[model samples]
Target chain A: MTTEHGAVKTGDVVARVEDLHVHFSVSRSAPVRAVDGVSLEVRRGETLGLVGESGSGKSTTGLALLRLVDATGGRVEVGGQDVTDWSRRRVRSLRRRVSMVFQDPAASLDPRLTVGASITEPLIVHDLAASRDARRSRVAELLEMVGLRADMADRRPHEMSGGQKQRVGIARALAGEPDLIVLDEPIASLDLSVQAQIMNLLRGLQEQLGLTYLFISHDLAAVEHMSDRVAVMYLGRIVETGTPEQIYRNPAHPYTAALLSAVPTADPEAERRRRRITLHGDVPSPVNPPSGCRFRTRCPAARDNCATTDPELYEVEPGHRAACLYAVEAVEEMRAGAATTP
Target chain B: MSEPVLSIENLSVSFSSRRGVARVVDGVDWEVHPGQTLAVVGESGSGKSMTVLAATGLSPRGAKVGGTVRLRGEDLGAMSEVERRRARGRHVGFVYQDPMTSLNPVMPVGRQVTEASEEHLGLRGDDARSRAVELLDMVGIPSPEQRVDNYPHQFSGGMRQRVVIAMALANDPELLIADEATTALDVTTQAQILELVESLQERLGTAVVWITHDLGVVAGIADQVAVMYGGRILEHGTVDHIFGSPGHPYTQALLAARPQPGVRADRLATIPGAPPVPHQLPPGCAFYPRCPVRGDERCRTEEPPLTEIAPGHRVRTFYRAPHSGIERPAS
Candidate 1:
């Protein structure tokens, strides 16, 4: 099925980001480079997962995509239109094409209004519907679309569960019929079972609506589950980008490998035999990041070249890219070790 | 295994408000022997933290707590209020998820940690200060002596949490209650804290009641696992039993819902309904509405008692494996 608005069909680029940079300036300190020279693309009908630590700039990249946060330098193209330095009116118009689902649905939702009113408010703001009855029916349809009961429209935000509130949030984002949806930590605050339900709902909604999602989260496994392509970010830079199989099994970058390796497996025997790469130090402040590579301080494969040269993301294999100078060598050793293990 | 370091029986906690009286924890019987870690896994409002709080006499105001909490054969519930307070730090150490709130921002990290040693062990002055430095060093805090003088805000988040762990270990208590200790930290920091706790547990042989929602961490660290649903223990057994061959339908669904690395599925397996709130819980099984394999009518009308499936494995339900075929035959 085609989306309500726009002609963005399957296999087309919904959002394109090139060398994007977002910096927060304080009076007495150096600018915090939250997102530094990162580039990615989200194709129509696909979920592109952006993953990193708290200060790794994944959220900032999502905000930049939605025009919620301003970019310092670079181009952001949403639905074949540039949104980097657009006027206020243009950005307001762009809002209809791209909507965002916030991390905490409870905090994002206005408790004073019922969920149905909350969902319908977007329709009125965007003038998507002609009349009140039409908007109410549209909200009901959206509630059912996210697997919520139609009777739940009258309940306040506090009356619903976390998963149900998130469904409302998804329904609100879908109200404008956005071609690209920036989902920021969608299922981070949910229970394991409810998280599964929400993830499944999200995937099913994407399939049904033909929506493209720039999914940003810190959860590696959940990101891998929802993403068609995964980008690993570290201290404001994209360290690696690849398909889930390439990123998870044969990670090229040391940061990516360490991030994946640190995840404690659920299988008891597998956890016992797993080789852990424990990164020693905390993430450095974004205000005064490292000179070249921000991850050099904690990277075990770091050498003299890391401090001097900021490596650009180079294609190590077909369609898989990494920014580490020792990407090939590090991944080769990991593969060799895995191959000889059994 | 050695004798049980901490034993709790028939523990239940309820809070009364204008809304109503809600029983948060219900009739839980658990024991942690020395050098054993019992992970209480549950989601929000599942009474995981309340179980530990009631045992330690830290329940909130207007809350009624009933149970017997024994520490090394001594009944803490029978003890006087002051005696219980003394038993808390000297015998039981508590670690919470948020370190910033646990530690005093204005006080030096040294004084906060040393305060435990001073009050519990009665070591004062230079002795307490030196012991604080040693505890900090034991928890892998670099430059222990210098950092000891620094306040909590001076340290990084991971460092502050390490200081909290240091303080938790200051008295070298036999039982440690860590409620989502690493939940607030980043993944890398979480790995470091887990390693620290594992090493400290090895050296100290502290019986730990580690409460968390992450199944992966439970598999990595705990010796035994207790799966809690609506403030009730749905299943309890060895980690191997819980992970390898789960018995309860709730436990089976939780394990399946979790997304693990290197495992892929077109869609995640999900329990269909939400967990019942404490106040609105049904008279029978709280998970019956969501249990895919619930086949028996008795599950909706009669509350299942905790029945032993193996020597140590127990499940609080009567849906035998073969009776239900929808999902893993009730398991």
Candidate 2:
């Protein structure tokens, strides 16, 4: 597929994953493939939504990007430098350029440390700020940037609300002045209104700081609003990649279609009119994924070919790509049929 | 019209915080008829949970509750602690968000379910055990007898939730309070849990109070809905009325804020500002700060009481006009 809107140029790639694979050894026989041969890029000043259900390697991918979990194979390049083989000291230096905001803010933030100290510690550890005075000033500035009051710095994580603590987490992630931020469900714990505020703050910060984001989330709607481009993952591989409009309006992958259909429409009349595609059965165990195409089990349009041959991601439209053999023809036919029906 | 199975009127709950008396739930009113699901929708700290929590006398210590919670024409608030305890597990059952936390980790699933029945219904040993296995099977847990002996840790997230539901229904309570029961489950499991709940409601004719923040989940399950903000009910109406013709700005913003799958907007109409803290609520409409349709002095100075808009729909907006053609009662 050719580069579309917000597609990262080779030079603009802030973080690049090349054939990354992460596997965990569980006994002597075989290993659980948490992330398998995933390749994607986070561009400067762009949000790439990495979306999937549980056990789809979304979290593992984020972890692999940060090198928190060692990838069994392939390379991770940050800012044109291959950090995949970096030492502890080198990795620590690299951490200053890449930071992560966890899904659960309450669990991520230290209970013993005050919010101020937590944010400032990152600055001090990374040597981003010169002195105590500088670190404090940076912490306060970051907090204010995230719309948190300066006085809240002294409070513990438990004392603050879920949204407030999440803001603190964002502030801490920003303390090192990282060019790339891996946001794993940053607003999942917050309320709808609060989520909006946080998302707006994130977008504003990205604009002001030129931050690159690898945004991972299960909430497709939030992802659509936040992401410039999206990668849909099933099991441990990227099944489709496209712009939000392309994915939402003309999803080629059947799993993508079912996921989009499952989201409830706010408009009652529209909801009644729309046909919801329900995928039967839960996600298969990642420990033992299905043969050939992993999505074949739940895919509505699955054929005998899908069970024997894994389809590579092929361009269905100008820039939209899907990893299913029949997706291109089927999607085109469906669109044409819809146009004629109306 | 038939009387509601559960009616909560003029409900107020105050917690004695170190700062001062914080009104967690203030002047909330709600009703649920037999076989109907009433979803109390709100964000965290919106008092939706506290309102229902107070009804069952389940509020933490040092919290003072003042309200009339009438269940089947009986005032639950008037009862003593012992009486309320007996009434709670017997007539009113509660399901929490994290099933793992609610169910005992060490105890077998069968023992847990039987414990509820034994305590509330006075069923003993073999009888309670038999009933427990039956309840498990009813909730769609396969091989109830064998699975019942398994610990909570052995069950999947969805199965754990099913175990919780089985325990909740052990006494066959008339009113079931599900406090974000399906929040922790995946979408597919959520669908199954909701289907189970709906089917159970049909079979038992039990009134359900589902408290959640996910508008999508509520749309699937709720027959009636109440949108709460800043410890107050901002809008209360039938599901069709609330979703189709939202009267309050908060409710409208909530509906608009949700990102549906296919709907693409330039930007989601997100209401700015977080929900106000309990101690720091604005004097006027609790939602005035974030309300898109802000009126003049009235919305900022004096609080608006929940006024009827139609036969069953009510809204707490001083602005009499409904934004989307829903009729409002004359002041």
Q: Which pairs clash in the backbone of model 2?
A: none
B1-331: candidate 1 lDDT, tens digit per residue: 6778988899999987777888899999999999889999998889999999998889988889998989898999889999989988798888899998899989999999979777778899999888888989998888898988999988988899899988888888999899999887788889989988988998999889999999889989999999998999999998888888788988888887877566678799899878888877787888888888886789998899999999899999888443311222232
Top TM-score prediction, candidate number: 1
lDDT (tens digit, per residue) of candidate 2 on B57-152: 788788888979987888887778788788787887788999988888999999998797788778998897889889999999988989978999
Clashing residue pairs for model 1: none
lDDT of 1: 0.86
TM-scores, one per candidate: 0.95, 0.88
- Candidate 1 CAPRI category: medium
Q: What's the distance in Å from true for residue A178, model 2?
A: 2.8
lDDT per residue as tens, model 2, A1-342 = 222233446888888887788999987968888888788888888899999888889999998877899889988889999989898888998888889999889999999999998998888787788877887888788889998888889999988878888899999898888989999999888888878777877888888888889899988888898898899998899989998999988898877877776676554445445455555566877778898899988776678988999877877876688888888565454444434542
